[model samples]
Target: MKNHVLRPLWVAILLVIALLVARKLYVPADFGINGRNFTYGYYRKASVNDWKEFKVKYKGRQYCKECHEENFDSISKSKHRIIQCENCHGPAIDHPDNPEALEIDRSRGLCLRCHADLPYPGSHRNDLPAIDPEEHNPDKACADCHNPHKPDLEG
Candidate 1:
């Protein structure tokens, strides 16, 4: 109870012993808890063998229904059925037998990242069909008048 409470209680016990010796010299020995069913919650047990040796670059939409079954049956019945054929044709992991590594993004800022008009009042992304990106035809390309797999046709 002196040198102003023993100099802030010995500077808070030497700052919790220098943060437990810098968390045992910067924390890594299979970081903690993530085992017996904890999955990726608290990980680094070699991060589940480095996410099972990585390399799974988006093989989904049932692997594009094994070779674009007609653009996966017109994107599984249009309005972009929950959007996926590599989300604007990017990662079909060295795609379409290498259509120049397939990146058909066709910009217009990636279709205004979910069409612009951005109202956002209670948002479920304003029910998605927004436009007005400088009044629609902002110099062409929403696949040149919409045909995102039959997105209400007219292309």
Candidate 2:
């Protein structure tokens, strides 16, 4: 009768509400790039708007080098000069405050973090003479072989 029909309709409405709630919680609508006409998913791009929203500055090693001429000059000679400062160390925002006071991350493990094969741009070679912890003593850091601020191969 009317009771049976109403019961099924109520259940259907509840199910629809549940699905909407689940979608809102788990599914991120704006997760992809917002294109001109449409949008993009993980790999797929929108044919309309391919350009970036805003311009980004090159706030990496080169930016740091411009300010720290003396330190930059010294590090220029090192093998690590080819590598960016943020590669081994995290970011260089606070390090400039008191260069000596800041505990610059000089761990062999940090070097191995990228050299492990993650392969970000300008990453060092795996064969580039890093000491193996299992094979060698842990007392050695990258600084042991190559001086960071004043690493002159000629010296």
Candidate 1: regions farther than 4 A off: 1-47, 58-87, 100-113, 121-141, 145-155
Distance from true location, Cα of 117 in model 1, Å:
3.2
Question: If scored against the real structure, what TM-score would every candidate get?
Answer: 0.25, 0.44
Give the least accurate 10-residue stretch of model 1, judged by summed lDDT: 34-43
Which residue pairs does candidate 1 place in steric collision?
none
- Tens digits of per-residue lDDT, candidate 1, 26-83, equal 9998778754555656766786887889897777788878867887987777777788
lDDT of 2 at 26: 86
Write the residue-wise lDDT of candidate 2 on 1-155 in tens digits. 56977999999999999999998898655445444443433433442345564444335878777777777777677666777766655656556666664345877777665444443356556445544566555576766875665555357
| Clash number by candidate, in order | 0, 0
Q: Enumerate residue pairs that collide in model 2.
A: none
When summed lDDT is taken over every stretch of 10 residues in candidate 2, the lowest stretch is 39-48
The reply for model 2, stretches above 4 Å from the true place, is: 1-58, 93-103, 114-126, 149-154
Best by TM-score: 2
